[model samples]
Every structure is written in C-alpha cells, then in structure tokens.
Target: MAASPTPSVSRAPLGTVPPTWLGKRPLPETSDGFGVRKPTPPELRVRRFTLPDTVAMLPGTGFASAVVTPAPARVIARSTWRPGCPVKATDLSWIRLTFRGFDGARHTGELLVNRTVVDDMVSAFHDLWDQRFPIEEMRVTRRDELDAPPTGDGNNTSAFVCRPTVGSSTFSQHAYGLAVDVNEFQNPYTKGDLLLPELAGSYLDRSWVRPGMLTPAAIGAFAKVGWEWGGNWHSLQDRHHFSRDNR
Candidate 1:
C-alpha cells in the first residue's frame, strides 16, 4: 500500500476574537426600561380551534407534529419533598402538595400553602392521569423545589429546560404558571444545536414507541385551559411538555 500523507494541524489562531455583541438589555430595573410598553400576552398555538382530541392537529401541520395538551389529569399524585427528603417544617404551612407518585397519593397534613395553587391545578389533573401510569409504579416530581433544571447534569430523572428565545425574548408562560415539564425521562428537550437528553433509559428508547402512540388523552385536559404541549412541535418532539405560549 502507498504511504498516505497525514493531515497537518494549523497551530495559528484565527482572526481577532470579538466579544459576543448583540443588542441585549437586562430586565428593567424599574418598569420604564420597557418603553411606552404594553406587554402583549402571548398567543397560544392551541387556541386556533377547539382541540378535538388529546393530541390536537397543529394549526400549520407538517411532520412529527401535533400539539400535546397539558395532561392536568396526568398529575394523579402529589406531596412535598425537600432536596433529600428531609423534614424542613414540622410547622406545616411550608409543606406543598407535590406529585408524590402518579398513583393518586396526596401529601396533605402539611401546610406548604404555595402548593395550594399547584394543588388546585393538580387536582384538576388527577382525574386525567389515572390510567396513564397505572397504580403499580407511578412517578413523583415537584418543580418549584427542583434544582434549577438541566439538572441536565444527568442526575435528575425528571426535568426539562427550554431556554429563553435568544436574549430577553418575552415573558414565557412558565413564568406565569401556564407551562410544565413533566417526567424528564420520557422526553428530551432541545434548543438550537443542543439535545440535552434526560438520562433515563425509557425516555431515550424509541423501540417502545410507535408513531401516534403518545398518551394523548392526558394532554387534552391541559389544552382545555390553553396550555400547549411541546411534544407536538414539528422539529423536536418533547412528549412530557405543555405550555401556553409566552406569558
């Protein structure tokens, strides 16, 4: 065989590296930084028509797309859990009703009042999730207390992160309690070139899934309230997500 030349490496650095500069402004220190402004509400991708099923046809449809409605019913369970399952407040009000497991278990007795909001929402969901996970092995999760997602570090079993659009895009529904990221294991979130995968095995495995096999019934309940499921996006299909546009 003839000897092949080895590819040479260029040791020189390219031209001058300039700092990332794009017109970006910080959050208004006061409200005026926002000029003569009326913060327009985000238009939900779901409200164009009544959702006929849990998986509604995306308004402008193409491949790998369908709006997954927020499955409020999927929140069949809830309870409070500290970072390490520690007891922070025997006092009561500090406790929150979080999803303890997918099987209809409620973590009441504790106060964690902020949970009242989530509780109201979850209560609306429990009726929807009963059949999806079954009573055998349901999952548990809480967002307000989770490590800022991306817990992306592969340690978390459930957590998804959708970064802001470029810079200070707009107020997202997530900010106003209109969006949700569910059991991260069953979904993988994306942004531009990033495919931050959830480390759980089932979420990444495609064999267990068939086209149109998503749990649609659960998603519909959430759509009733205007939340849009990210799973329905055309480019990337994140099954465990639903949101109501920018809040």
Candidate 2:
C-alpha cells in the first residue's frame, strides 16, 4: 500500500479571520466618549450573562457629582446697572451669584439690589444654591426697558425696575431695586383674572409644586434674611417675589 499521504494542513494570514473567530483577549483600556478613562483590569470578574453584586462596572454608572464652588463676590460693571436711573448706582449693587439653572446646570447670575441687602442676598442665594433651587434668569433691568409692559412681558429674576405698582402710581419696591422676582413663569404674580406672565395659569394651584417654585425651604431661606414673600400678600399673590421691606 502506498504510504498514507502526508496529512495536509491549511493556514491563513493573521488578517484573514474575523476578530470574533479568535480567542477572547483583554479589551484595551481606552478613553470614553466623554474623555473619561474606561476601567482597565476591570474591578469585577464578570462573566457572560452573570451580573456582579455591584454594578460599578457599568459605563457611566457614577455621577461626576455637582461641584458648586464658593459663591463668588458681587461684581459691578457699567452694563450691570441701568443708566441714569432714579436709584443711584451707589445705593444699588450688582451681585454675582452662582445659581442652579432650570436645566440642572451651574450658571452665574447678576442681581441689582439695594446695597443694604447685598450681604443678606448673598447668604440667601447661597442657601438657595445649596438647596439646588432653580432660577430661570437674573439680570439688572435697564431703566430704558422698564417702559415695556409689566404684565404678559418676558422677564424673570429681575431686581430693579423704575415702574409703579400695578394700578397704582406709587413706585413699586422694584423701582428701588429692593425686590426680586424669581422664576416668574413658574411662580407668577396673580390678582383676580390677571396673571403677570398671562401664560402661568398652570402655576395657579399652589398645591402643585414644581422646579423653581418657592418651596418652604426657599421661603425660609429668604426669611432668614428678613425678606418677606409676596405670596403672603392680601389681595394679589406674587409667589415669585421676595423683598426686604419695612425692615
């Protein structure tokens, strides 16, 4: 009998077979899409179809944790105050504070308030920040822009406005930069059939609380500074308002 033909063997280049066909190898440590480094030599010895006691291995499982730095000191600039207003700039200050925005991100806001309340404003806002209360916007109201309609107009977290109280010629507390209206769209000024934003009917029910609405904690925060809430008004309810009046 002829000698058995030598067994034949076939070989292919390293590039021939798909990677999946090869034996499993350690995944190379790489940067996550967000630039965070993925785990190397993973903390857990997870196997196929088996979950670890802790899920720390899951991608993005942990939060970066919000870091609210020390609230910065108040900053003053020309644009921070309205030009030639009834209230002198010297009596009013531009306060810069860190606020949590409606989107849950950190933001810097400016409030033009009477100098007497700057310290109180800082302490109050710091408490608000620690509580993560949301603020829509905060800026100094320009004297020229005060002529715009107060009701149904777009403004939020404004302090100073040279305008009279509704239906009264007497200047409003805002005219003296002693009041602040926060998250107006979420906590509107209302009286009878009228609403400041006009579109804030949803917030009419004080029972239903939402982000940016004044929680008891927020009210307490301002109260600590001797600020009164407009929600306590007799006729109209200005849930978003806070002022240090009759102090």
Candidate 3:
C-alpha cells in the first residue's frame, strides 16, 4: 500500500502577519507582533531592516544588496590595531554593504565602527544610499599600511584609525572607533596652508557641488545622530571627518 503523503507546513509571506495559535485570535495584517503598526508610505522612515537574520537592508527596493554584517577575522587582522587601544575587536563591528561609486555602479565595501554607534553608522549610510550619493571607496585602515606616508592617502574612505591627535598626546576620537572619513579625495582636511590630500585642492571650492562631495542630505543624516561634521568646524576644517563629538 502506498503511504499517505506527509502534510506540509504553511508559512506566512515576508512582511505579512504569521498564523495565530490555537487559543489566540488572528493578528491584524499590519501588526508586526510588537504591538506597533508598520507605517505606510510617506510616513515610512529609514530603518534597520534585517533579511535572512544576517543582512541589513537599506531603504528602498533596489538596495537589497546593501547589507551590514559583523567584521570577519581577516578584516580585523588587517585593520589598524595595537595592544592597549581604546577599542577592542569585540567593541567594534564590521558592516559590509553595496554603495554607488562615483561612476554610478554598485560596489561592495566594508566599514569598521564602534558597537556603540554601529546602528547610527548604518543609518547614516542608509540615508546616503537613499540619496544615491557617491562614495569613492570604503575599506578598513590596515595596520601595515598606516606606516606609509600620508601624502596621497586622502582618497581612502576608512574608519577606526588607531592614532592620537596630530599634535597632542591625547588619543583622537578615531582611536576609539568613534569617527569616520568619507571620500577623502573630494573632502580634504584643511588647516592653514596644509591639506591632507594634496591633490584635492579643487574640492575646497564647495560651491561647485560635484559628485563625492558632501551634500545637504549627507550632513543631515550624520547630524540626526548627534555626529558633527568637520566641514562645520572653524580654525581647522576636516571636511571628510565625522565624529560623535564636536570637539
């Protein structure tokens, strides 16, 4: 005799309400099980949307490729690190996501940020992604590469530079994994006659408003989470620098 076919368990569709248990009433279609109703369009805001329990999606449909994840062992080993650093590997996270490059094609890159602001960092990038902003490149600051002279390092979009203040003995916010630099080539750090990226002299003319430059959207995104951009500073302007502290 042929055995009866096994019953298959049905599953709810993504973003839809799940099935009700034997004793419970069916949940509202819009309820997300946390008693909060999902906001409709126009009210929907950027969110940390998780997919497959490992990837975080950016706002909008086409950006599903944009995801954030913990740093891999190889990434940690390559990043600028040393003993007695203010932040340890456990205190930081690695986010891997797709970003639009200056050429308008998708590129995958990684960023290392403190766990304290990982969510904020992701949110900032999400806003940038939604705006279709261009990022030159994003990579971890490799310890081995830090020894190289800083003459033409401005184009590197990096975070967690384990270093102290340029002229002070105190550790900089970057040493704590609390700061980030974006599109350094297009957003040079300027102080007096000095420019970090010697080749980025043209970007000093912010009125031009070109790709890879800081736009209002980018500023608003970082500011929303209490980060201060170097572009807004006086005395010394580091247009590529963004940190949690204004000092």
Top model number, TM-score: 3
Cα lDDT of model 2 by residue, 1-247, tens digit? 8898998788643322223411133222223211112221211111011111111121232211211222123333423344545666567665666666655666666666776767787888888888978775666555444433322323357776667776577878877778888777667777775565643555667786666778999999999989999988988888888988931
- Candidate 1 structure, TM-score to reference: 0.39
The TM-score that candidate 2 achieves is: 0.63
| Best of the candidates, lDDT | 3
Candidate achieving higher TM-score, 1 or 3: 3
Tens digit per residue, CA lDDT, model 3, 104-209? 6555667788878887887888788888887766777778655543333235667788877654678888888899888876687777766655445666778877
Query: Whole-model Cα lDDT per candidate?
Result: 0.33, 0.59, 0.65
Structural similarity to truth (TM-score) of each candidate: 0.39, 0.63, 0.71
Q: Write down the worst ten-residue block by lDDT for model 1.
A: 43-52
Instruction: Give the Cα error of residue 65 in candidate 3, in Å.
Output: 7.6
